[model samples]
Target: MQDLTQAAALTGPAGGEPRLVAIPRLAAGGRWRVEAMRAISEPMLLWFTKGQGRITIAGVTRGYTAHNAVFIPAGVMHGFEVGPQVFGNALFFGKDCTLPLPQAPHLLRIREVHAQQEVNVIFDMILREMNSDSPAHERATRHYMGLLGVWLERQVAKAAPEQTRPDAAKRLVARYTALIERDFRTGAGVGEFAAALGVTPTHLSRCCRQACGRSAITILQDRRIFEARRLLAETRMPVGEIGASLGFTSAAYFTRAFQHLTGKSPTEFRRSV
Candidate 1:
């Protein structure tokens, strides 16, 4: 295992007001690492402008390129592997200003050109207000945050429409999503998720793909990894204990699976971030 004394540098706003900070400022030069996964005590949004990298949450890893914004709720553990090419601002908001958000961590890919521009304006305003000497800076930032919340809600609503999916398929996948969130640490697999939903594994796969663009098994694995990353980064628990807690049969197997999806061994990753 890598040495634990050299932990990833953790940085954030140091006040009682909402704030925005450029990613490069947090990690100097062309490097970005928050590898040791840990929970954000406040609601934080990392909006990427350039570069591409993998982001794992709840065991689901996705290739996040440009124009991706990850909304992490307070208390949800997460990490990063962004580089210098990455250009964006990290918006940190107090719990009082955090808008109503989905209960789970959400990764949003903003593709619409006009919508992208709109968010950009809000980010600019936030940065300005965050660094300004005005007395209303806090209130102004909060107003901009509200706009952000609205835009994010609209984007989510636009991604999936009930009319586009068959009612039965929607219901099944919704239940499947919930089950994975609740039982992922149990080491449940695709077959089990299928069985619980009263459908065959093949049927589950088809429905999940049709409704969510990912397989049911993929969802379960992502949830497990999301929790695993948090445990590895936040605690000094022997990896074997973490693996066993997450329902991994063996430590070696856990390392392999975590590395496969996250692109780094748990030990190396925990230290790098």
Candidate 2:
């Protein structure tokens, strides 16, 4: 989860049109840590043209090389460490330009031969748009972004699972995630979440372990912590107010939880950022 706020500052304010940043060929022996994991807080369309690299997202690691393209949804923790340093371009757009996906926030890894070709072309188009100084550059960039969105939708459609196992445990965990995303501010406990999902607390814990690799309570806490971080980085609200907003009964408890997950207190994080 890269801190998008800082990235935005480094890149300067958003231009009237899609701004293109060309990362030229890496120096023969130089290494670059483009940005910390926390710097990438927004959804980004990324294309890798020439390099081998490893990306870690949400505790899942994947290796990538030349001609590989990936769509990283917003708010999902992700960062890349490149090997054989590569060159690519990233097109950052606001929510208005982003297209909806059938299954959201899942990384769409492009693998099909034809689909890879299409992705390559999109990368090339981005390079062309960056190089061209024509008056129509913005229009060209927007068109290519639209094309990229459509391509992503197609790739997700092709790659997404037809159906996940319908075990009751899995369903229960899925329902819990949905509810947390929708109603975390309600201060609901694990037992309340299980009851709403029509499962016993013990069953919910087991289901979460099998499906999400964590207990229901852990997932809920993570979501709250994530939201707390988002506000700390994005808003000027006071720490106590933020705690109350997230349903924390006391600011001290919220501070402890935030420190446990982020290794920094809310005020510390906000000040450092």
Candidate 3:
């Protein structure tokens, strides 16, 4: 029963009368008020109906205005500040909603009148289904969300060559990410990863920079740091043991690295969470 209208997550794909898409009512004037640099594991789409504000993803900030549908990939740091006159629909899909989901954050404005109207209609239908008492509510919600994904993909396609990636770039990053997820605990560097992918380190880093908005080393650091936070919050592991297990040369090394990137020592991070 948490209010995903602002900031949230879901276990997986929605079941019924799913809370996947609903209009977020802002506090007081109209601000989302989630500014901390935290990672979300679920993919999300944000559609703004009016007003403008700043949306920062991966340390980049952009203006969000009416009819802007922002596609946020899973496992990235993002925050939002909506202006007072703004109201919008936010759709939270589990990480596995559909194939070709964006692997990075992108903001696209729905410029066509018909496309804008269609998006508005879909959001309204989703809200209605979520409130209904029908047995097939969840099924209906899934259908609508699938449609949302299709429209979003088209919008992203228009922006891919400029801000995002082409299919080839996506494939390369996908392979790199898969290898990192499987072997990050072993303390592999960009060179080792590039070797495994059969590409030079420079080539791999170029792909990551173009496709992920960050360098290859930064991506590895993020994956490691995200896991460190998860383990610190979810388990009772000792700090030193966590460092050694994550392939850090020493406990002090791990602490320094975590602090440098997250601005918090491991213990401080654990306490905050």
Candidate 4:
């Protein structure tokens, strides 16, 4: 079960108005911003028209190439690596979006030319309505969002099922990621998380490595660091408070960890951004 306190924190934009916006992949805050493991308050759709890279969602990593569409629901941990040759559009459906969306993440490899054209048309229409000064443009945008959802549904339904079921390692790692998303702010370490999941720290770490090629501790730290970066870039929260809120024992330690992972101290990161 999700902890109510943490789940509440996950809902709604903490600051500013809700936004439904679309921008090119390169404009979506660059590579590190997208390549790190993190969750956002809003759902997002990525339409990859060119290039290829790896993406991790729900603790599973997969390669993505051109004509691929990835849908990530709000509050789910996801990240992707895109190179200079990569090109695409990323559409963000705001926290307050009322349109029905898949509860899980999806990566649809669009093989049919007609299907690719259909998705392109939908994206084009969405961009058009968003940039238009036409009356009820917001409504038009909502309708287009619905169409995009429908497109995802059809593609997901048509896709072939996985050849093999999720193994024990994958299942355990998925659960571990879910718990990290739930209580990462509490500063719980790998042992505590493993205990809660009814496994020893060694076993959990082994499974995590088997599933995602990273140790359990590394995954937990990545999550915490991701939140630290978001707070530094998006808000005026004090450095000490941000670290404390993320369960860091001291400001100095937070700075060290942040610098080690991000190559910048908290203050320096804030300044650079």
Candidate 5:
């Protein structure tokens, strides 16, 4: 098994443990580390201080430029594409955190210089506290996290007036993504998911493309492959068993699908990591 304690994908706390971790946006894991479809069980704050990219959250796609902060609540599916010039930090508030936070995701474009500086200072202070060896460092970091929640609220309020409610297509895709998160491991296909949601597979795919620029089947496959990579990297489980557990009918089929999406077979991918 691999030592994945430092992996960004494992941002969720274990055994109800309270955790606060901050890491560089582009860590050593892989280029597509943060650009894959997955969901975390804790609240996350992505502070993009420089560069620009496109982020898809809750099945809605939007361009994220410099000075942007995106707050994603637990259980929301999200991913983004960033180039070499992009840089930022990802902060995770553990599952046991008690701080007040947004119930829904918020994408804030900080236009004011003061507001931009304010968020940067808050992130810096939190990071410093995290790195401190003082006995009171944990308490200090928690307080700073609270301040960040407050900052997010204020920015969200300022953007609320400009916000519009999600239309039917967005709503449907959101539901579809949520369903995917819940049952991706069960081997359910996109058609099963669409049927459960009272929609046809064609309609679901159309909405997904309109909302996130990806087809429904593509999203489903991305999610399953994402989990496959995680299992391969973090566990000693046999390759065939892992594929079966993820609803793959055969190990050979799983390998082909995994390679088609990730450019590597399971054995090769595990060894590379």
Candidate 6:
């Protein structure tokens, strides 16, 4: 066992690029934890060649095993607990690394599928580029990173759902997400959602729980809170104006709800960032 708090400290210095770091292997301790929010100033692509671990992003936690890869977009808060026995390579790219692919947003999760053999081979090539002592190492590394992007784009396409969620329970969850994205700022509640979806409130709640592992109200609140956070971070709107935009009649209520979900006042969060 290793001291979870100090595991990341043991890793060596970053590589030549200010925005990039080459991690040949994970920390020696099988377990590590980052107790606070960890922000990424740059995009990170982590390849877990071997090991199992758990990662929490935003408010969602998920498990990861061998051959798992994760892409953390810039500005997201995420942290991971890794098993000491893990072996992996981490690549950090600057904010301007490359244009994002059209389907990149959908590839948010670490799919429960193995990488194709060709993809694995390309990963090995990247490892070689990292270790090479040649003068052209920088060029080689950049080319390999581009290749990795192409491979990931293919994987996302292959794994994407071909059809809309067909199961009635899952469809309910999908529809809820769509509706929230469209009308979250309108302050629509679970009862309104149930009415619009043509289902009883109780039935809607049950369906949401069965498919998303969360109640309808909780999901709705989370969606609204997320939008609020985005506005706070990305826009210069006054707190009251932002709250009103989100359908809150009173800024006090919006402030309280935002604090409850994010553990910080909207003003405090905006200033801190």
Residue-level lDDT tens digits of model 4 in 1-273: 234235535622242322434324433554556777777788888888898988888777889999998988877777778777788788777767777788878888899999999989988888888889999987887888889889888888787474246789888888888778878888788888888889999999998787777899988898888788878888999999999988889999999999998888999889887
Give the distance in Å from residue 92's predicted Cα in candidate 5 to where it truly belongs: 0.5
Assess the local accuracy of residue 190 in candidate 6 as a C-alpha lDDT between 0 and 100.
78
Among all candidates shown, the one with the greatest lDDT: 5
Q: Assess candidate 2 and give its lDDT.
A: 0.62
What's the best-to-worst order under TM-score?
5, 4, 2, 3, 1, 6
Off by over 4 Å in 6: 1-64, 69-117, 120-166
Please list the C-alpha lDDT of all candidates, in the order they appear: 0.69, 0.62, 0.69, 0.79, 0.82, 0.61
- 46-161, model 3: which lDDT tens digit per residue? 89888888765654556888988988776555557755577787777764565457776789987899989988888888878877889998788778877877788888887667
Tens digits of lDDT, candidate 6, 115-233: 54555676677667777898997688788778877777766676567524347776665666555545666766778878878888898878777664567787777656655666786
* Ten contiguous residues with the weakest lDDT in model 1: 1-10
How many Å off is the CA of 10 in candidate 5?
12
Query: lDDT per residue, candidate 1, 42-119, as tens digits?
Result: 777788899977664433345787898888766554456666687888887775555675565677888889998999
Give candidate 6's error at residue 193 in angstroms.
Answer: 2.1
Worst-scoring 10-residue span by lDDT in model 2: 3-12
Q: For model 3, how many clashes?
A: 2
Cα lDDT over the full model 3? 0.69
Candidate 1: residue 231 Cα off by (Å): 2.9
Name the better of 4 and 6 by TM-score.
4
lDDT of 5 by residue, 106-167 (tens): 88889999999998898889888988999999899899989988999999999999999999
Worst 10 residues of 6 by lDDT: 4-13
TM-score of each: 0.56, 0.64, 0.60, 0.90, 0.91, 0.52
Order of quality (lDDT): 5, 4, 3, 1, 2, 6
